[model samples]
Target: MSKEKESVLEGFKAFLMRGNVIDLAVAVVIGAAFTNVVTSVVKGVINPVVGAFGTQDLNMYSSCLKAPCETNDAGEVVKGIPIMWGTVLSAVLTFLITAAVVYFLMVLPMAKYLARRARQQAAKEEVQEVMEVSELEVLKEIRDALVAQRGSGRNDPGRNGPGQSTP
Candidate 1:
């Protein structure tokens, strides 16, 4: 029926609008932006520190061999290849800086936050379970009392026998 289809569509829409899904989307966007900031920090701040050691930028440090490798206008080497150690050094430095920043600033804090949140959620669930069990126990006690009262033998037409009807 069209009504059933409308209900199903409404339910799906509600599910998508839940807090968890929205929070996840926001986190993803923020995480991407954070990555760009970290990358730029590594390229700008960290690169300069490494460049202080008499290196014409990290990308130019290389061990050359037979010839001072000649490159065409398109930056392509025509004859011999230059052992580009500078590029490798720069990459290594960038990787190390990025790793350190991620570990200290993002990973550590996120881990601690998740651990704390999990502990709090577990405690809340345990309390809820205990309360539910207590409520069920009360209901069971009332049912048992009613059963016992009906089972007790009685001649009154309005009252049931112990655990039985008095019709």
Candidate 2:
């Protein structure tokens, strides 16, 4: 049981030391911070600008029924239920804007850079492989030459027929 526990601990230690795991942790923290900034931008700058051209505030949109929608006053049932579509519109707009910014600013450039790096790496690997094959061919030729030279030598007397009388 002790041995098993030690092995598990060793394995966990190796996992924690891996570069990819550390990089992923860093990326998550950065992404969380970036999200806060984007959210503030949506709520503060974009929402107000959109509200200026519209009849409703971005935050006030909701669906209400059975009573006066505003919490301040109670009105008769004759007035139809109020459904706030402005809030939904604001949310949809924010999502679109965020997605566009992330795609154009981060995702696209990262993808292009990665593709270029991969191409460069592949070219390097191909060159190394060709060099290795050429070296192997040279070694094979040397081996073949040695074998041919040995075969050309005269046979020794000791290598004659096995049934011959001993000296």
Candidate 3:
């Protein structure tokens, strides 16, 4: 039982040490840190700009269905359903900011780089294809010249290839 437990622990340790597991852990940590940065930016920058249009604190925005939403005597809600629109709006703005930042800072540049690399590869292949076609054309011309020389009657002295003469 002790040996079995030891082996199990070692197996678990090995599993945790794998590259994928480590990479995933790093990604999760970085993602958390990035989230905090984005959240700070939203709170610091966007909230103020959006606040110009309305309340700076979106959490304060709400509507009560009943006229008497609260009772001052009890200091609590007496009768009414409060719709918290501010919370929803805050979440929507945060999402939009995150999406825009990721798209502009990461996705757009990566896409452009991949597109340019693909175009360069295609140009190289096109040039290689043209060179291959040119080589084939030259080969065909050489073959035609050889056939013409042979058919023109080898008895002629001038038509023989260099280093060869009609004997």
Tens-digit lDDT track of model 2 for 1-167: 69999999999999999998999999899878877877788888877787787633676655676565545355433454877677777778767877898899999999999999999999999999999999999999999998876555324444434455546
Evaluate model 1: give its TM-score: 0.53
Q: By lDDT, highest first, what's the ranking?
A: 3, 1, 2
Residue 81 displacement in candidate 2 (angstroms): 7.5
Worst window of 10 by summed lDDT in candidate 3: 67-76
**Residue 85 CA displacement from its true place in model 2, Å:** 4.5
**Which stretches of model 3 miss by more than 4 angstroms?**
1-29, 71-78, 154-167
- Candidate achieving higher lDDT, 1 or 2: 1
Candidate 2 wrong stretches, greater than 4 Å? 55-57, 65-70, 73-87, 122-167
Error of model 3, residue 135, in angstroms: 1.1
Q: What are the per-residue Cα lDDT tens digits for candidate 1 across 46-130?
A: 6677778665367767765758788899977777768988788767766776678778988999999999999999999999999
lDDT of every model, 2 decimals = 0.80, 0.78, 0.84
Best by TM-score: 3
- lDDT score for residue 68 of model 3: 49
Clashes of each: 7, 1, 0
How many clashes show up in model 3?
A: 0
In angstroms, give how far residue 140 of model 3 lies from its true place: 1.0
